[model samples]
Target: MSEQLPKEHVDILLAAAIAAPSMHNTQPWRFEVEGHVIDVYLDGSRTLPAEDPTGRAMRIAAGAATFNLRCAAENLGYGTWFGLAPYPEEPDLLARVVLEPTGARNDDLLDLAAQIPYRHTDRHPADATPLADDVRVALLQAAYAEGAELTWLGETEVHTLLDLVLDTDLREIHDWHRRTERSHWVGGERTADGIPSSALGPRSTSYPAAVRDMGTRPADRLRDERQFEERPELAILSTYFDDPADQVVAGAALERVLLTATRAGVSASFLNQPLEYDDLRTKVQRLTQRPGNAHMIIRFGRTRTHTGTARRPVADFLPEEQS
Candidate 1:
């Protein structure tokens, strides 16, 4: 076995991992450090049955956290090796990551680590300023580097996606279970985990909003309503398959893309309502007209910096013995 990482290094790694974005900032991942290996697990209790009945989102969140761990290790001058769904018996074990000392480190990942603390979901309306061509290509390359494909939607495709989002929102309007789940994790006072109302952004005044409104209750109405940009830039991140492992790949690709955007002074938010339903998810995939299952719907543009959501301490994610 490789030499065990010191407690301080493990703490640094876990802090970066939990900063990853989840469906509603659930931070639904746990870590176990044995020697130099970090086992990533889905905290099943954090699963949103109504919002994610199949646990796909939870696995994706785990994958994203794992990606952050890898980046942090690289930044710390170590090479990272990881496998997804490595054991059949341990279904919740989403990934197993091993870090080893390497004389050379991945400069790309190291740069991404610097942006981790700044990468937050920007829920506010973005300006009409268009994304530069180079920035767009870089975001695409980031996803490709992680074995995933990102497709930026055209005007017609964005319209189609907006329609799907509207349909999904209408369907969710009466889903008491889903609403309750969202209420628990999102809005209200700032908690160690989950997004708070302050980060929810202003409600959209237009119908078929380009961004998915995070507001859940009548209290959300008290926030100002603003008109979102008419032509919001959108992209879909996907993998060739829809298996559990592929979902993790999608999440890693997502964090890479998001961090890349943050490095370029661009802001992003998710319009993922359509992806929660199987039928709507299929339609979202069709919008891309590509050969992959859509895992995330991202809206990227320029916006002012907003207060980031809070995260639990590193000890909160460790086992009792480790803590």
Candidate 2:
């Protein structure tokens, strides 16, 4: 808080922040800077009413951006301090980050900064090859560093999780509103935001994929059908509790894990449909022995498909200049 950060540093931080993945690539975050402090707010206009009714995923997305901000700041010889929901009265204001010059740099987070742009969501079928044991250990450690737990699922848990993911497909298929909301963000010629058709990967015509079928929807005739891996490599990320603050913390951990995976040559996608529902979220918690609230279901493997999602420009996310 004592240091006056340069504008160029803040610009680099915001650039890294917007690169964090969001649900359906909605990129629901905005920022304002006062002195050296940056306030992160949720964009109420970009809500996913159908996919994220409670705005849980929205907060997580913002949290990931906040983490990126912290990482970028540290790499620039600055230390960051933040609090979630600093102004409870203003609920849309999710978190505030203060950047101060630090004589010592955080090399670990600085290393992660390099992976920010390379970590894209991979929706295609991950090859059946198992992750290297050491790599799995590294990923788990990465989550631990962020105050969250990542559990690699066994066969039994994977089967149950797959069932839960498929159940969501059934619910989505019958709900016109839900399908329509999803269609708005996926398999389109969207340039700034939303998943582009090429990033949609192949459609799963047989068994339900752990990943959502953004490409195969009826309106999208351009999406090609293909079989996904019958059994995807999966993991469950959970926080110690479920609340606005914990959700944000989980988002930070999620991004750390993602960057670690990217550095290790692993690609990932989220099976968020099940985690979107209260009932399904509870079940996923139980599958983890009720240790904590399950925030995300992630699938990982090696895929050559580098179809990264779209991101809005930093100018679009930056707050208006102070008067």
Candidate 3:
């Protein structure tokens, strides 16, 4: 049977959920709580039609939020049972989670919960130092635990992937809609949601940047320029299918790997430009030599500390009746 969680517990869970990273920090999620049941919904109004025409990125972000909700529940001595797209009639409802009182806790999830506040997308150049083998193994295990595959790319594969990214970037340069949409959420004045200029990393001095250049405006040109890593570590996170449910699973796996990297003192960022195109996405899957749809291209390494983007208060996500 479900238990009635205190308001304080609900607050912590919602806070953790909103902390999950989204593309351009859109933070496109909503919540409703009744007793011990928490419903997660995709805020359709927040969608970036130009960049995320298929809504794949939004679903992934919702999945990340769901994972965080579970972790927070476990941390508070509650076991969670959740389902993706639980209501067929309510297409916007992405997930429904029930909290059950469990005296026992998931130690692994507890450890991950502790790292939540520390995990941020690092856009600056990472140190050329490679990840330790054991660390790589842990990241793989983290993904497997969440029902996804994380494949580390080889030097040649990384180069090939970089070529695809460059092609996508060139295509985006001429796409006015995409450029405007990206700028809407990134490299602007600080806001409650979306990335601020302060967190926008320096521009890369070389082409085929390991990091996505988020500086999209003339004012952004004034930002500092730095040399990014020549051979940065890269990995691909994939799922067995391209369905909405599968995308949610991919997001959960992505967050697990991110938190694991954070606990190991590794910084991470995304190179998801290629994944936005169908052909380039297929090529990315080919790089894996594995049977799955590529969802994200993650770059992991050690880097100097950087501030995380801001998030809206939990109250903003609650429905009017609940609020």
Candidate 4:
């Protein structure tokens, strides 16, 4: 008889899924599976209550997990079938995926799957060298595959986007409620979820205008003033609708671009500040010359940093059956 598929296979899949970047590397999600049915849950403990008070980021994270699970199952020779939030009682359960036998594997899936571990959110200034035309095209194609579009901001447009992000940051920083909520995620040291000071680079005061400052700590003292790149490459991910499902698609696409960049020897960091504030989100939509439902901004280029950020062990988030 054929050897039984280890029940631990689902846990392996969960490990791969959480490796995807999240806002603040929050890793804001959980999973449960029985047989082939896998259920994804949002771990409230990891929620970014300051910026994403209503758990929007958690839904986006779950959406990213859904995409990763699909790719992983295909790599393992299983066709994926999924449904969204089948049980109303379990509101945090974002998705349910079922794996079915399918004897097929392709290079595209393998190429992306190979990138699962290498992808990291590099915050250090990207190399000043501009991206080649072909690299930009490839990255754009990666976004399109997941039903989203990427708009590369021109040098002339960078300042406008920066202003919107900074404005959002100022609003968050001054809000007493937001301040308390952000403090809850970080203790004296780094944990599995939330951005750690070590990962925030040496910058002090505020984060770059294009990045979200999840209120972990001011790395201003550690940042190299000259090393900060003035004209970082900026790209926006957009969908036609501004709904929960659109956020998920944008997130999955965001992960696809991130992993593709990792495989291509490019490093990326994100600035979700514009999307965090409603007015700023509208401004980004106008700036991108697209619909007003922009989900995130990603800055990418070559960077010298090589460290990967922290993540909770897969067993911690996996359901008992798989664990």
Candidate 5:
């Protein structure tokens, strides 16, 4: 058997993997290296039960990390092969990435890998300027290349989607348990995981904004109100199926789209409140007028804010080797 991967390379790949965004920034992923194969597992103890009852988001987040690891490995002159749920008995094992020597480098993936460290989830108000046609095409193609579909939302469709998002807000507000569960993750300090107050964009003005309001705590008085962009551009990413494997690939596609947008100097935020609920999610799908599960709803444009949440050190998520 080939010797285990070098610690230095493993660290770099793991770092890139952990940088992936998870639902509520939970960072619900763990890594274990066995020989040349590195495995990804869902940290069930960190699961957001109320927000992700079906465990869909956990799988998606894991796939996003897997995508990043692949990109990082390729950039670093190594090739990676990933098998989702490689073992039938180990359901918690989300993926397995095996590293092999490969000096070949794909310039495009390398470019995306470079942006991985710099991509920040911009919740700040975006400029109302629409993206150029070519840029939009590239982003769509990015998702397509990863085996997902991207649909640009029209003005009417955006209005419908916004209404669904509003309903989602109401639904969440009514469910105190879920709300409380999600709020626990809105941290004040700059911890390795969880969205900090600094990264939480300014509060939306009195009126409803086309973005999610993760809600600030009373003690978080420093977060002043700001007007979000009007008529922000929106898109729906979808997959033909809603199974575990489909969700995984959709996540990889979502990351590809995000990285492509970042490379184009575009910023994005998730208006995924509706996607979390079945009733509201059905309405969201209708807006797409397509056949597939709407994996994510994205609002994107330009933003001056470069706020970013921190990821836990790789050591925190990786298993220690036994002597």
Candidate 6:
């Protein structure tokens, strides 16, 4: 039989796991390894009190980490058996993963695991070209593997989604709760959590806009206007239920699809504006013909600029309950 992976291998995987993109790169999680079992902890310290007061974003972040862990463990030839929200007493303990029977790592697993580092959120506008047929099929397959559906928004749906985004953005900008939430997540200097000014795409006057501008008011760093030249290719991930469990599942699928796109030489951005407002969220679901819960709206295509976002160190946001 092959030798078991060393402790350092687990640590490397944990690092790669946190490297998975969370909403705003929040990195809201920690890890605990005991023998072959790995525990994932949800750290509410990084939770956006205003935007994600219910800790949904944190759950989704943990889901992204879970996806990364699964990919890395599979790359090392271990099938993963994981339990979600394992302990009734410990709400922060999001998941526990146990290694399954040993086998050789598949090449596809390695390819996906290798993409953990290179997949950054490209907020700039994409080139005005549609995705290749083969690439789109691959993305669909990846999304399906995680129990979610990825559907492209047609012209009418896209315009409807764009309008919903703009309306939501405007409302959030004026709403006290949203303003407070943005401030809480962004920190004082755009140093950690939430979208940073550097990744806010092009700067424009307050309008019903699709993208959130972390650069608004006392602006720090902003992207050039030329990057927002064309409308982006938008897609949505939908699940059958609107519960926390389903949200986590949707998030995991979202990461897998994003990684697949990244591997296929595509760039993407997430626009959750429509869903931030309950009414708009419902409108979007109906518009997209989503028979279930529409979790997030994502845009993908080729991009001209690459702007790297910031992430909190693994030490800062990790919870101590499992440590």
**Which candidate leads the pack in lDDT?**
3
lDDT of 2: 0.85
- In candidate 3, which residue pairs clash? none
TM-score of 6: 0.88
TM-score of 3: 0.98
> What TM-score number comes out for model 5?
0.95
Q: Tens-digit lDDT track for model 1 on 1-323?
A: 34779898899999999999998999899889999899999998788999899998888788789889999999888899999999989999989998999988789999999999999999899999999999999999999998899999999999999889888988987899998988888888976988888999998998888877787767976899998999999999999998999999999999999999999999999999889999999999998888879899999989999999999989989999997
Candidate 5, residue 65: the lDDT equals 89
> What TM-scores do the predictions have?
0.98, 0.94, 0.98, 0.89, 0.95, 0.88
- lDDT of model 4 at residue 212? 46
Give a tens-digit lDDT track for model 5, residues 1-323.
35887788889988999888888899999998888888889998998878889888888888888899889988878877788777778889878888888777777788899989878788888887889999999999999998999999998888788778777777766798786886789858867888888887877884557778775477665578888877888999889888787888888998989999999999888988788898787778778898889878888899885869988878888766621
Q: Give the clash total for candidate 2.
A: 0
Error of 3 at 188 (Å): 2.2
Q: Pairs clashing in candidate 6?
A: 50-181
Q: Cα lDDT of all candidates, in order?
A: 0.91, 0.85, 0.92, 0.74, 0.84, 0.73
Superpose all Cα atoms of candidate 5 onto the true structure and report the RMSD in Å to 1 decimal. Answer: 1.7
Candidate 3 deviates by what RMSD?
Answer: 1.2
lDDT by residue (72-138, candidate 6, tens digit) is: 8887778888887877799888888887657666566678998888788876656668789999899
For 1-323, candidate 3 gives per-residue lDDT tens digits of: 54566878888999999999999999999999988899999998899999899999999999999999999999999899999988889988889999998888899998999999999999988887889999999999999999999999999999999999888988887799998898888877876988888888998998887888787778886999999989889999999888898899999999999999999999999999999999999999999999999999999999988999999988899988766
Model 5: pairs clashing at backbone N, Cα or C within 3 Å:
none
Evaluated at residue 259, the lDDT of candidate 6 is 90
Candidate 6 achieves a global lDDT of 0.73
- Regions of model 6 farther than 4 Å from truth: 1-5, 187-195, 204-210, 221-223, 227-229, 315-323
lDDT of 4 by residue, 1-323 (tens): 12344566676678788887776677888888766777888887777766797677777778777878777777777777877766778788778888877766656766788788777877676667988888899899998998889999987778888777667767766687766766666423566666665566534333445544444545433444434577788998888886666677777888888877877888888887678777778888887887747887888889885666778888888766556
Q: What is the lDDT of residue 282 in candidate 2?
A: 90
Ranking by lDDT: 3, 1, 2, 5, 4, 6
